[model samples]
Target: MSLFKNVLYFQAGFGFLANTILLFFYTFIMLGHRPKPTDLISCQLTFIHIMMFLTGGDICLTDIFETLNLENDFKCKTIFYISRVMRGLSICTTCLLGVVQAVTISPSTSLLAKFKHRLKVYMTYAFFCIWSFNLFYSSNQIFYVGGFTNVSETNQMKVTKSCSLFPKNYIIKGLILTVSVSRDVFLVGVMLTTSMYMVIILFRHQRQCKHLHSTSHLRASPEKRATQTILLLVVCFVAIYWVDFIISSSSVLLWMYDPVVLTVQKFVMYAYPTITPLIQISSDNRIIIMLENMHSKCHKILLNMFLPFL
Candidate 1:
């Protein structure tokens, strides 16, 4: 195996493991009793966790390119179709999450704030729409994707199934790229605008507090904390995703079939979802306290166990 393939496999494995742990943690631990059922932010995080799992699966599928048998053309097509759909949905859902967060943090005077209360109510419907859009848009891949047998003789492989886009269907490929790029651009704009608004608001609030005769607690306010967390999340999201998008876009434009490009793109694409759990844990005070409590209890238990042996 090539160095690129080895790196891709490692990334796929890590992403899959991280997402799986996060899914379980959210479903069984973090999601119970603390956050209200009607909390839009909580629902949004749950949806993101699902997207992470799907993305991890897509990465894992790409990692196994060398091991997959190409005997059945139908199976190859199915794998390609599913992988494309999942990857598309992952990107779409991630964009939706950013948009939703932006709206959630908008100032009360802002137009987006009017819809804040409706986030939980509309979130499920929005998720459905995102999934449907990706599903339909990616259906073209089902018809165009082919195994190694259909690819050029120079790139043919043994004991490996390759999924390649048909050169004749350049129009469909263009459409896919357009939609994906447009969606990402819109989301990035929203996040940038909202983050800027948040910074301005925080600064103004600090100034007002300083001018007041009576001292007021501003540092520990929940609103301020949430804003800070959101800002951090936005920064991380932009840093990881912008680079990945650039790489993917460049690869498409150059029509490069290099395994190294694909490998880098795959890792960068999935890294965001894998690392999201740590971001959430760090930002959430309740989770942090719970973790500290658990650690103390474990320490006590270990001491007790060693006391008997001593």
Candidate 2:
């Protein structure tokens, strides 16, 4: 295999293995513990993580197969479609998560306050809407093959393949770009504005508490802690994602498809999900305790259930 192909395999395989471990630990061990109903935010995060795992796995397998000079077939097409959709969904879900966090942290008197209580209630419906939107938006991708190709009369290599909607269908491309750009912009804006607001609020609250000699208020402010942690996460996410977006967008605009860009894009998409566990671990102590408790309970239950058979 060529060096580029070898790199692709290495990256994809590493991503796949990492995501698999994450999925197992988070979904089975962490998420399954205690069997309590999940909140909106938790459920959304879980869904995104699962999708990320699957997409990573697909990318790894597809790249491996392509490196082996395998021919594209029906299964390849299916994988292509699913991978594209999952990637798009991952972006959408991450943005949704940021939005949810922003809403959660918004002041009670804010316009979003009315929707606060309904977030949990409407979370399922909101996910359904997002899923539906992505399903249709990516439906045209079902006809694609995913692999490297050399552009005519150029040394530039691109990942090009068939799709239901070709470039001739500018309307569809326009709609897709519009939806994608609008969603990304909104999420980025919310993340930045909310984070800034939270910082200012924290500063003001600290100043007022110090003035009043109320150290307890400063220490016990859930809003301040949640806001700060989420702000950090959003910052990390945006930092990685903005670079990926710029590179990918540039590739598309300049029509200079290159293997390096493809590899980087894969890394960024997979990294988001793989590192989420660390974020959760740092942000939410309660969740860690809950997961541990659930694990213990499950172990006891499993021992009791299997002891007789043993």
Candidate 3:
């Protein structure tokens, strides 16, 4: 209806579409071709984004849970918990992606190179651990979030049109906040570290290329392009994540959720997931080539279908 609402709808629709395409691309790669080391993580992240759109009502244009006709409290708990888990997974997978890329680009003599043979094994283990941890960590949402009641303003913070968070004692809130902050900070730190490492590696490689040849000879390799994509994603994720962290933390601590602030926070929070697939799609030459092939095939089919009449 409103401009803001239209933007929200467009954002959700575009993001959902992009993520689905990316997911299918990775799925096809894994099934028919040799998968890259980072393919699994990319696939998982795309899945997470899709779930985020489905369960996170603020980001999704529709209230998907409403169609289920579940009890209000159950619906609230289910949505919040699943959304929290997906949010956690997004960061975890992004961090893993960067770290994997860093390892991928590391020089053969470097220490990280030693793990190259076993990187896939380690990534499988990492996925299991990340999912398990996020599932357990976000369980608190089940207890804290529920349908709004006639509770006093001081005792409840409205989270959505239908859901609100029950007030907890300062100690409980403090503990939850501490753990959340710790996890985010640690993951963000890892992203930054890996990003810096990749930058150094790229710089050195570029320097070496320049020394050996003219400037025009310095084309970005597959590894370099992948690294750059990951770095850009990390920067985008971190910037948006902190903006959301600040907004959410302030709302929780102050026991207030301003309508405008919440709206802005939703936009900020979904921005990363929305843009991630676009970044991947644009940077990935394989996907581009595949798309081009598909387009040409369709064009040939159309010409064949119409040429007899002409």
**Which parts of model 3 are misplaced by more than 4 Å?**
58-62, 151-154, 213-220
lDDT of 2 by residue, 57-95 (tens): 435444565566545554455665666677666666666
Q: Rank order by lDDT, top first?
A: 3, 1, 2
Best by lDDT: 3
Looking at candidate 2, what is the lDDT of residue 87? Answer: 67
**Tens-digit lDDT track of model 1 for 67-120:** 666454555666666656666555555455556665765678888888888776
Q: Could you tell me the lDDT of residue 203 within candidate 3?
A: 89
lDDT by residue (tens digit), candidate 3, 109-148: 9999999999999998999999999999999768988889
- Stretches of model 1 off by over 4 angstroms after superposition: 1-6, 29-31, 34-75, 102-110, 153-161, 211-220, 296-310
Residue pairs clashing, model 3: none
Per-candidate alpha-carbon RMSD to the true structure? 4.5, 5.9, 2.1
Regions of model 2 farther than 4 Å from truth: 1-39, 57-71, 144-175, 211-223, 287-310
Better of 2 and 3 by TM-score: 3
- The pairs that clash in candidate 1 are none
